[model samples]
Target: IQKLAGGDICKGRIDVYPKTRENIQVALRVSRVNQLLGADFSAEQIKEIISRLGLKVEAAIKGGTLQIEIPGFRPDLTREVDVIEEIARVDGFDKVDTIFPVASVRPVRIALRQTMLRKIREVLCHTGFSETVHFSFVECEQAENYLSSFASTEDKVISLKNPLSSENDTMRTSLIPGLLKTIQNNLSKGQKPLKLFEIGSVYFIDSQGKRVQKTVLTAAVLGPYELTPWKPRGKEYDFYDLKGALDNLCSHFGLQVGFPANANRSYLLEEKSANCYVDANELGYIGQLSPDKTEIAEKVFVWELDLQKLEKSLPPRPHFQNIAKFPETYRDISILVDRQVTSQKASDLILKAGQPLLKRVELYDHFEGKKIQSDKKSLTFALSFQSKDKTLSDDEVSPLFETIVQTLKTELDASLRE
Candidate 1:
C-alpha cells in the first residue's frame, strides 16, 4: 500500500527474514503513538519511519479486516495492534458523546378569557347550536360584496402569493361572508334550519393601512324556525330569531345588551332588517340578509360580536338568583303612530318613560288599514311593573303608568287608542 501510495522505500525490494522480531516491535510502537495522538496516520508517515531500515509496507483489505502485506523489502506487517489502530481511525467519530440534559415538566394553565369562550360555546351548543370552523381565506369578490368597509385593491390585502384558487386568495375581512358561504354549502347539501356558529380570528385593514387580526364570534341561522312534517307550515328565520339568540348570549355572559332605536345600518341589511348596539361599550349587530345578497343564502339571519370587547365585558362566571316572590303588575298601552316610525322607537319611548317602575316592554300587536289614517298605524305594547323591595298597590302603580303615557305623548307624539 505504501508503494502504491507513492512512498520511496516501498519502491525497492529487500530481505525482511533476518530482522522480523525487531520489525514487529517497531510496528507495535508506531501503533501506540498513532492511538495516543488519535489522528489519521498517512501511509507517507509510516513509510518514512520504516525507510531507514530499507523495508517496504503495504496495506490490504480482506475478509473485512485490514492486513499488512509485507513485501520482502518491508517488515512492518508483523503486529496486530498496528492493524487495530488503522481500523479505529478509518471508522470516523462515531464514539463521541452526544447526550443532553433532560427538560423540566410543568402543568399548562388555561387562560381565563379562553375558558370563558369555551363556556360560551357550551351554552350555545346546549341551545341547539352546532360549532363550525371556517377558513380565514375567502374570495376577494365575496369579501368586497359582503363586508361593510374593506380595502379596495387586492394587492393591499394580505393575500396568498400562491393561492389554491381565485375564490381563496384573500384573507377574510369579515365573518359574514364565510358564514354565508357555509350556509350556501349546506343548502347545496340539502341541509336546512342549520344553527351554526364560529369563534375565530378575522383579518382587516386598520386605520394605518396595516393588517389587523381580531377575534370574533359569529352565528348564522337559516330555514324554518320550527321544523314540521306538514308542507309550508314552519316559520322561516327572521330578525326576531337573531335578536332572541343575541339576548340569550348576553344573558349567558351576564352582560347588559340593549338595542337603541335608529341604530346604524349594516351593509348586509335594510332599515327594517338590522339592529346594532353597544353592549356596555362592545358593539354588535344582528339582521336579515339584504334581499339582493340573500340570493347567495336564502332566508338567513346572522350576528357578530367583537371578541376582544366581549372578553372585556363577559363575567368571569355565572351567578343565579331566585325568581321574584311578590306579585307583578302588568299594564297595556296602544299608540297610533306614523308607519315610518319603527317598533324600536316606540319601545324605546315606553322604556325611557316607564323608568323606575317598568320591568319590561313588549310590542304584541300592530294594525294597518284604510280606516287607520294612511300615514298612521296602531301598535299595542305590554308593560310589566314590579318593585324589588316591596309589593305595590294599584294606586302606587297608577301614577307611574300615567306618567309613562304622558311622556310617550310628549316625546313621540303618540296618542292612546280610544
Candidate 2:
C-alpha cells in the first residue's frame, strides 16, 4: 500500500499526508447559542452535540463557554456560528421556532445628485442629443492634448501601471476625444443631424500630483440642424444650436449661467468659444470646434461642463405660483451698441434694471448691416411685463422701460435705435 501511494517503502519510510487535524479552536458561548437559536441550550448539551460530531471540546477560560477544536475533515466548523449551526443540525432544525427579523422599514429615496443627473439626461434627450458611453481608458497622447489648454502645465494625465495596450494606457482627462471619435464613426456611416452627449468620469492629476476624478457632462452637435424632405441639403448646425441645447439643460435645473468670450481652448475656435459661468464660478465652455484641429470638413459645436459645479449652481426646488390674474404686456427696444459689447451684457442690464415689473426678456433680433456703423451692432429685445396683484398699465411699464433704456445708454453707451 505504501509503495502504491508513491512512498519509499524499501527505505522503511512513508509520509502520512495531513499528519494531524488542523488546530482551529472556536469559543462557543451557551448564552449566545440560546439567544441565536431561541432555545435553552446548556453548556453540557452543546458539548454533547459537539462531541457527537467528532469534535473535541474543552472548558473555555470563561464560565458557560466551551473551546471547540475543529477536525481537518470538518473544514466548515471554524467559527462559533458554525458550531451553533451544527448543534441546530444535530438537534433538528424543525425544533427551532420561526421568527421574523425586526427592522425599521422606510421608503428608499433616490439621491439628489442621481436625480439631478437623470434630469440632465432627460433634458438632453428631449433636446435632440443622444447619450453615449465610452471606455474610461484613452490614448495617452489624445488625453494629454485635450487637457493641455485647460489644465496647467504642471498638471498631467494619470497613466496606468498595468495597461492593456499602449494606445489605451492612460485615463481620459476629457470626454471630448471619445465623443469626437464617435462623431467621426457616425459621420462615416452617413449619420446626419448627429447630436451626442456623455456623462462620465474624467481623470486628472492635480498640480500637487494627486490623482483626481470628477464627473463631467459633455455634448456635441454636428451635421445638419434638421433634415427636411423639401431641403435635401439641410442647414448645418451652428454655435447657437449647441448653446440652445445647453440652455435647455440649465433651464431644466433652474440654473442661470453666462457665456463670456474665451480664447483659451486650443481645440475650439477662439472667436467662437465662450466660457460658461454661474456668477464667478466657471462651469465650462461652449463653442464651435476649430476646423483645423478637428480635421472635419463640416462644422462641429460642443460643450463640456463640470457636473458638480453645475449641481452647486442649481437653484432650490421652485415654489408653486398661480397663473397671473392679469395680462402680460411686452415692450420692444432695439439698441445700437459697439460690436465688442455682447448681447448677454445688454440683456443682463435690462433684466436688472427692469425688475419687479419685467417678467421675461428675449433677444428676438440681432442685425449687423451696412446701415449700422461698421464698429457697432443692432440688438432688439422684447421685454414682457406683468403684475401679480393688478393689471400693469402703460404708466407702470413705461417708467421701467425708460429706466431700462437709460440704464443701457449710461452703462453700455447704447443708443436706442429708431
TM-score (all chains, Cα) for each model: 0.66, 0.73
User: How accurate locally is residue 225 in candidate 1, as Cα lDDT from 0 to 100?
Assistant: 59
Q: Which candidate is the best by lDDT?
A: 2
Any residue pairs clashing in model 1, and if so which?
A: 1-58, 56-73, 56-74
Per-residue accuracy of model 2 over 1-418 as CA lDDT, tens digit each? 7657766446665558757666787888889999899999777888888899999987553788888888788877778898899899999999999888889999989988999999988888887789999999988988888885346678999999999999899999889888888888988998877889999989989999888888999998877657567544657777876887788778777777787657487888876788998888888898888888777887888898988888887777875778888999989999999988888889989999999889888887888899989998999999999988998898888999999989998999999998
- The positional error of residue 380 in candidate 1, measured at the CA in angstroms, is 3.5
Clashes of 2: 0
RMSD per candidate (Å) reads 13.1, 7.5
Clashes of 1: 3
| Cα lDDT tens digits for candidate 1, 1-418 | 5558876564566766655443332233444435554555555565544444344454532333322344443343455554444445444447433556468988899997778798889888987898988888899876665455323344244677898999899888677776776788888998887898998877766557777777878888878755556535666876666777787877777876766543344455555454445543735667666668656647777787777777777666778888988878999998888877888788887887777878899877878888788988999999999888899889988988898888878877888887
Off by over 4 Å in 1: 1-109, 149-156, 228-232, 261-266, 316-325, 364-378
Q: For model 2, what is the C-alpha lDDT against the true structure?
A: 0.85
